[model samples]
Target: MGSSSSPSGGGGGGNGSEKEGNSSRPRFFNKKEKSICWAKAETVPGRHPERWRKDAADNVVCKRLFNCLGCLCFEYDHIIPYSKGGESVAENCQILQSRVNRFKANKDEVDTTQLKGYSCDIKFTDKELDIIEMAVYGDVIRPGNQCRCRTVAEMLGKYKSKDSTAACKLPQSSESL
Candidate 1:
């Protein structure tokens, strides 16, 4: 599914301004590109949860608190640093926890060698991936942006009760998994 050209059909350079000979800044991922990236990232086994939950108890003390059902939130991350010339494509984006994303910053690429160790039996449909991405990245207060979790919960249907929580719980040690 890799394309030589960007989804925008532009093939200049990382900044898309190579042809013009004016390379100032890297090009930002458009909405559609971001969506595609998020969806593709979600399909990876052992990927981080698309959303995170901070219960009311946890929210009372957390530094950055969100007020959704169970304080659900999501963050979009670049797998490779844009500053390092990583294109904003599906293969180079990931959904990460807010705290993890903050700690990661524009440092280095995430190591995926360990992902093979995690056994993930869950399979998400494209629509489900889209909803999860929107819930985590979309502005929650706006009319259309509100209640993304509810939409996802509905899509999950029977599995709603079982998978409602999307917390990012870190393993304590290599043996924890």
Candidate 2:
């Protein structure tokens, strides 16, 4: 053996450091964490009418819903507000929170609705964003693991705050498209 500066006792620097690495592996998220993720993932699928199918297909549907996309039930969301000349087609419909849909009240909210009558790209609320983030990240363990869910929103918000023309013209559907 090579000349040892310190013996391999409890005070041994090399041995102590090496032993630290052998400690029990860290546990993954506990049951509560899993439940929260599952709930967040399924929120949209269970609530929205038009989006339920897509949400189910995207694995955002709750496990209670047959755990299959085909079995998911959906409803209609007005892509273009009836007041603003929107259609009720699947392409135009979306899965939205009941509260959100009610808030809009069968008409377009100028601030939330796009000018050209496309509601597919929605302005998400914080709760909605949380679910989107969870779905994209597959579990929120670290900030470094953040997904691209809000990147476009952040960029758009930033550009709009600065009144940047480039960002203003960016197509709204691009976020999910």
> Best candidate per lDDT, number?
1
> Taking the tens digit of each residue's C-alpha lDDT, what string does model 2 give over 1-177?
100122321110121113223443211222343233233333443243222223312323223332111222222234455334443223344433222333343455434333223223344443453354345343222223323233465666763234321211222555642
Worst 10 residues of 1 by lDDT: 54-63
Per-residue accuracy of model 1 over 1-177 as CA lDDT, tens digit each: 111123442321133234312665434454565456444542333222333222111211111222111212234445666656666655676544343444455667444433222212244543343444444554222222232344445546744444444432223457433
TM-score of 1: 0.35
- Residue 95 of model 2: what lDDT? 37
Extract clashing residue pairs from model 1. none
My TM-score estimates for the predictions, one after another, are 0.35, 0.23
Task: Report lDDT (CA) for all predictions.
Answer: 0.38, 0.31
